[model samples]
Target: MSDSSRVAVYLDFDNMVISRYDNLHGNNSWRNDNARDHRPGSGDATDVRLAEAMLDVGAIIDYASSFGTVALNRAYADWSVPANAAYRTQLVDRAVDLVQLFATSGTKNGADIRLSIDAINDLVDHADLTHVVIVGGDSDYIALAQRCRRMGRFVVGIGVTGSTSRALVAACDEFSDYGDLPGVRAVVPTTKVAVKKAAAADAPVETAAAEAGPAKKTAPAKKAARKATAAATKAPTAAEAATALLLRAIRVGMEKSDDEWLHSSSVKSQMQRMDSTFKEKSLGFSSFKAFVESQGDLLELQSKDNGQLMLRLR
Candidate 1:
């Protein structure tokens, strides 16, 4: 909590969106298939789902919290553009100061320059700030990061994995891949289910059966209700398999940890370490918390005073 431990975060909004686009499409079929839909030089908003997936501001903030108290948060972008509108409220809700940079003729690096300038200014003016978190993969900020480090401030970098520059990542004291963040989850859309209405004729049969006695009730109805109850209480077989894999991953981390209670974030990191292909989305859960909670029969969850979820096996 001390001023010397304060951390400041800087975000390059356009760079982030472009990086995410590359990660999702990247010269693949998605680009060719959607080329007609997305016209060149349109300056239009990208797909909402892709945008949301790329820059998960909340998840990034939560990840940064593990480092230290975030004292200053700023994001640079041209707010007038319709493409950036969807992300504005998200930034505002998180108290990120939005620095607007309008597009001008023959210039494209204004936002990047502004972000670097603001970061350097914060380093000079804020004596308490000891950490700087740059949330972009652009090589332009490499010099800025070096300057902050030379001033004795620890620098942390965050960027999309494949699209990030290796030099920029190496410039920081620590680097985090945005895709690997705990709360960054891709939700697979669910298929619609068919609904059946109850028939009027069934009402008389139920009434007569009840009037006759409990013995007259159809066995199929009772069996169906019991099956539904059981299904609700217990996870499906495939889900259990996924739960077992999760536990194994966590157990590997538990061996290295000193405490019985581990932060949910740490558990996720361990999961990735154990298996790169493991993703909660593959098991039908949107977040790690949901996946952990699904195995309630085998685990117990408690909220710490700091608001971090602690996991323990039952």
Candidate 2:
């Protein structure tokens, strides 16, 4: 089935890739490190590395969006250098259009301008375009989000946290902190802790000695694999599945309705309010939405409205 939502994604290669390295790794060079922050001659290499990194980012999103039924995917960059050759290859592989531009003798590079112009033009031209996703770090695009909203289009900005312009974050309908995106956070080997316990609990005492001895090395590995295999096969239970679906619906409602902070009482009241018959105990849940909230991922308890629980982000 085709998704009803239509979104156009724009990648600003020069601005965002630089953001990954600069914000996370910092300018690797002495010049960038010691130079006055963002000052000329400052060893800041974000500008140098940004273009290459953003190209990869564009390619990834180009692929992800397709699965989500995104209607448009475009990457912006100046393509004179051989360094950007890898970028071009991935862009093509991911079916992204490479919007190329140039720098003139008196003027600066116009990649950002090109990106902005094309985004706005398409927003007006394509009535089906409900959401515009931007891949970039420079705060310059902040105004674009506000402007697009005025024209009645939802704008979603993507960038590493702390690198995106505060203006951009505040202006957009929703900002996907690229840093927190799935598979982006520093992997803490969450399985490691879980594995040791599983091995200790499941292995027979005699086998435990054998396994924890010379064979012990492989025990963690086997336990980890088993855990993963089990997780892959186990579908959410009826109660859990319903909770997960409702949580997503709530998030979608907040996004579409321009309500960033949904009231806790309203959220609790609405689940039951939707159907007076919608009860927690009947669904094998303990306390209505509370039971639902306990089982999901990517959602968190934000606060309370009086005494009720409020959820913010997952």
Candidate 3:
């Protein structure tokens, strides 16, 4: 896809909220609590527990912006629910169009159908939208992803990790875990206590002799642990990681170029596309050229006859 991408974002708000809740609490805990009946702006709506796992609306939209300008941003959910209403300010602040869907039954919210229809309509109407960002994990979106790709638009999927369907991931051109997005922390699963309790209940009773013997690491295992510790202590610093990223970008740019050397601008664009959050200035460099020159050990830079700078893998 072109670097000058026009992005259209479709967010399934309820799907994200419920998935995040299940990720933090036990599975289906939100449903068990009868979250739908929780009135807007009520005590249940402002529950501290739900706030802990509340989705970061700005983080997702900011990440989408990295692809290109977000021309159309829409979120679908039943706004009457307090859980969804809690995000009204953040959504409005980011200029996201709130598309509300009323619940027809306890289990059947028409978010998926409405979101799909709206996305299709937008794509049909807007020829300039080159990228489609689907912000939900439902397998129902697999067909939408396929259809969007068939229409020559790059489809990006953002979904909660465990709650996301594997089939949906395969269908999209690119897929990102919501937790993995910039400014968002990964959700630590809350099943550890339950797992420990289950293990204790099912654990076999040990004989006196077996209980007396505590397992010891073998000599080889000890040596491996020592090696691993050494490696961890010698882990790459941030500068080294940035240099590696630059080198990889240079290699990719060179591979795609028809000439012997790739333009400096092209390499930088490749880096930004590979990592939307990448910024040479953020790494203490004055400019992209300065950043490239810093990695002199792994890259070669030269000026063309017309004074245009070019780079190649050393």
Candidate 4:
């Protein structure tokens, strides 16, 4: 919040941007109706319960102040393509300034060269700067980090794990893999691509929530659902199936043979045992507790210990 506490963010706008977009949002390919209806926030794939689980902004900001006060946050990239077109809005929305560069004719690409020069100039001018966060994996920034280190400034390298140069990290006082960024767990691999086949799906009738996506929603991120489903496979239906399976699974575990009640924790644990990946959200309910309450008639749900839901067969 304070300028002294601020750390400059250096982002590799092109490659990293593409990677995040593809991993979070599905690609425009294929003939899968499920892909269209089940993208992350859509009615079908509304599995992510919390807003935090859906979007991880904290990770992007990174922890610059961890080592020292970051005086400059610069992300380097060439914003000359349509692929990079949408990112402009997102950057501003996040309050991250995108430093635009062109793919030049020389040895050092324009982005790398421009960023390095700017970093050097800042080091010479900003005496209070304690650390410089190089956000790209490109080794071009390595020398700049080294320069900052020689000048007594901590050089913290941040980028995708393995993508960053080990040499660069060793040269700097601290290094953090972008994948290791605080809130971003892992990139979900996109499996169901509707862009290719949906454009070609025979009739392409509005099978599911066809009316919803035209404006406000994106189907569930199949990647998240796939991971969640893989984790929840044994407990209930396939990942693509409804939230009904999870509810029933919990009910089955919580209900006694005589139709007596069971603790909500017992049901939650049972569901988790069936699939460690089973989260109240990945199934599309507001909370694991909410999912239990929604099982009305088939089951009775209540709060016992600390406002947590308890369950029993109806």
Provide the overall lDDT of each model, using Cα atoms, as 2-decimal numbers.
0.66, 0.57, 0.74, 0.52
Q: Looking at model 2, how many pairs of residues clash? A: 9
Which consecutive 10 residues in model 4 have the weakest lDDT in total? 28-37
Q: Output the lDDT of residue 126, model 1.
A: 91
Q: Sort every candidate by TM-score, greatest first.
A: 3, 1, 2, 4
Candidate 2 local lDDT, 145-211, one digit each (tens): 8888998877778887666788888888777766554323242233335546756765667565765
TM-scores, one per candidate? 0.58, 0.49, 0.60, 0.48
Tens digits of per-residue lDDT, candidate 3, 125-244, equal: 999999999999999999999999999999999999789999999999889888777556554432344344444643563354367685342333333334433432344677875775
**RMSD to the native, candidate 1?**
16.3
Q: Which rank order by lDDT, best down to worst?
A: 3, 1, 2, 4
Question: RMSD of candidate 4 to the true fold?
Answer: 15.4
How would you encode candidate 4's per-residue C-alpha lDDT over 63-139 as one tens digit per residue?
A: 55343333455666655543444345445544566677766663124776777788778777877766677766767
Q: Worst lDDT window (10 residues) for model 3?
A: 40-49
Candidate 2 local Cα displacement, residue 102, angstroms = 2.4
